[model samples]
Target chain A: MILRPQLQDIKIIGQYSGRVILGLGLLMLIPLLVAVCLGEHAAALDFVIAASFCLSAGYVLILICFTHKEPTWKHGMVIVSLSWLLAMFFGAVPLYLSRHWGGYLDACFDAMSGFATTGLTLVQDLDHLSFAHNMWRHLTMYIGGQGIMIVAITFLVRGAGSALPVYVGEARDEKVLPNVVQTARFIWLVSLVYLLVGTLALSVTAFSSGVPAVKSFFHGLWVAMAAWDTGGFAPQSQNILYYHNFTFELITISLMLLGSLNFRLHYALWAGKRKEIFRNIETVSFFISIMLLFGLTAFGLASAGSYPGVSSLFRKGFYQVISAHTGTGYMTIHPLQFVGEWRALSLMGVILCMAMGAGACSTAGGIKILRIGVIFRALLEDIKRTMLPRSAVVMDKIHHIKDIVLGEKLLRQVALITLAYIFLYLLGTLAGIALGYPLKLALFESVSAGANVGLSCGITRPSMPAALKITYIFQMWAGRLEFVSVFALLGTIIALVRGK
Target chain B: MIGKNFVKIWLVFLGISTEIMMTVFIMLCALGISWLISGGWR
Candidate 1:
């Protein structure tokens, strides 16, 4: 039996949640600055109103729930989960005010998608959207990728013990540093460094591809944020295809891979542990899975005779496979190409890649390569145990930043999370099919949303069913939190409803 | 001191370069396999 949450529990959760919302309010200032610089006074005013509202709401929560008590683990988890929902509502304020969405629900969906780092969009006339709104959309991904709670922990939240639970609640279990604050700073450092490098690379490629210098810089920065965060919102509806350059695609591919690496691995690499890149189980698993999926997709495309030559196959076929696998959702081809042109087998291949996703503790979502690696290693260990004599002892180990023994507890955790991901994928798929979409397209879009992958096979549109939109939003939220925090939030709700 | 700083910078550059090369290498391996399966060499 669970005890009902006390008022103090609510206060603790509210205080932390308010702090995170305050951090988000601070983040909204980025787009406001962008609007001011671009001389979009109307858009700047929209941001001003939204920011003020967010700040005011956050302050009210903090003031009302003011507490001297530190947040417990349950409180941290509750805070993280509630903060995401609140962030979505508050984040949508500016988007809704922009009048680009059909309703507040649509704005909330896009805001959730952005904050979850899932690239699905419900905004109307995305091509005609304001620079400030577009910046906010992509900026949400960058913030969400590092985690909104992490920003709070880095700046506002004191007490290392209190910060750790919130940090872990955001689906980042790996502590890159001993202290949570230092880890948060390092995460930001890695992202900022990559942002500068990726922006420059993309800007040069964009300028060479005929975009004006100023526009190219902005586009490059936006695309860099989107790709590096694996958030699929592109400034233009055409996405990567808008630039029409292979060089630009190549740069984005690099950014996506780099972004999907675990922060611990990034720390290791930065510390000059070059061999760690090769020896890390997640890296090896990703390399193997990507290659196999690439082959599967290539064969499917070739069998269908979709692309005439190897060049087109690499450009069209390979790029989408990698993008899907990385959960970046930077599509060069039109969404219709997946449904009308690509065969079922290739579609399945892309779906499988999207479901597998990138490294653990990274921005990208899905089952994660680390869990995949652990599962495979566990299987091998089982096989070895069966073959070995009764007296023989088998100890399975995998290298991350350090060597970790693969115990049953670890395997159980991996299996549980992987199963939960598949269930989430199926839930979305069933919802899609119930809404009259075909099984293949339903599965593709479901896995895309559930995996936080932005790839759409022509199903996600402004005119799509509102039920499906809400379903994908839930999937993105649950997927990004990896079900743990979501379940915690659900438990809290249950306790409130039925607990004595 | 200048030489030491230069060496440090060079090491960081080398580390970054190796990582990039590894990324490209993996991408190429995938592309090459795809090419082979597509019968492009033939």
Candidate 2:
């Protein structure tokens, strides 16, 4: 029998979600201050109006839904799913005010894309966008990458018990520290350190590459946030291509790769367990997968004679493979080049890389390497079991942060989530094909969106069908949350409608 | 006390450097293969 959620459940979900929205309002102040300082009066006005709306709405929700009760697991899931939608809607206010987007829906699309760390964009005249607006775009990536829940848990949410479900609901299951709050803080510590190092490195590179001093600093900071977040948004429209400097690309490659690493691995290394780098399953799978896929991509490009020399091929070809594999989506080549220049084989390699993605509990998206590694091990165990005697036991284990026996329960959970991702990928591909895009291009863009990798094969544009845009938005949201929380949200709606 | 702090910081730096170097090595290996297959040395 399905039990309908009570008013108390609604209160609990509303209270926590209100707190997140309140936190989101506070976050907008960073860019607001930037606009005021830069004398971007027009942009400052947009942020002012948007921040006021968020603050007002957040306060009203908190007041009406006031509750002292701690949220149950169901409430936590509902809050997370609802909070992200609220974030996308309210977050679009300032963006819509900027008028760079075609409509409010377009603005919401970019906001969801930013929060999902998917780099797909539909913004027009991106080059002429104001500095304050640019700051907000990349800021969403930073906050979203670390997670909005992490910010709230680290600063706003009290009690580890309350924070845990929301943290898990954000699709981050592994906690680096025992307490969820400590884990959030530790994640912050790592990112903040990388922010300093990455920003400084990129800033110096940009300056050396001939960007003006002030512009170089802002560009560096923005790019660092995007790359380390494994988000593909650039301050300029051309993305990494705008720099056209090899050193700049090299720095971004390092940042993106580092960004996609599991935070638990980061914690392990920081705590002096250096050997974990070599022993960890995700790293092993990542290394093997990248090499095999890059070989295929290289071969495809080679047979096509896509570029002239080794330098061009390595810089252009290998960069995209890393970008796709890490879920970073920062393209060195133009979008149409994938369709026009690269053969079907190379595009397929990139699509497969996007589908597999990078580490779990990090900014990168897709069916993470941890699950891929486990599934592969499970397959081997199954093969061994078939060959052995009837009474023989196939002892299967996976070495993640530590060695763990792979039980039936674990395999079932992994298989379900992996299937969900495959379904999400196919859904978007069908939507693209329905809109008259070719099969290969449709599949490439769909996997890119569903995996939260932002690479485009020239399909994403302001002019695409609204149905396609909405489909991609849903794909990004569902893919980022990993299905469970979204299912909880759907179940709640069903109960609200049908349950006695 | 200051020396101990310095040593800890240096080790963290070293760990990060190791990760970066490893990634770079992978890229170089890929580049080498691409070079060979594309006959770039010629």
Complex DockQ per candidate: 0.59, 0.63
Over 4 Å off, model 2: A389-391, B1-11
By summed lDDT, which 10 consecutive residues of candidate 1 chain A come out lowest? A307-316
List ranges where model 1 is wrong by over 4 Å.
B1-11
What's the C-alpha lDDT at position A420 in model 1? Answer: 99
Quality class of the docking in candidate 2, CAPRI style: medium
Per-prediction CA RMSD (Å) = 1.5, 1.4
Per-residue lDDT tens digits of candidate 1, residues A1-500? 98899999989998888887777788889999999998988899999999998888889999999999998788878888888999999999999999999999999999998988889888888888989999999999888888888888889998788898899889998999999999999889888988999999999989987899988998999999988898888999898888889889888888898888888888887777889988999999999998888888888889998985777888898889888988888899999999988998899889999999998888999999899889998888898899889998777899988899998899889999999999999999999999999999999999999999899998988889989999999999999998889999999999999989
lDDT of 2 at A92: 88
Estimate the TM-score for candidate 2. 0.98
lDDT of each: 0.89, 0.91
lDDT of 1 at A313: 86
TM-score of 1: 0.97
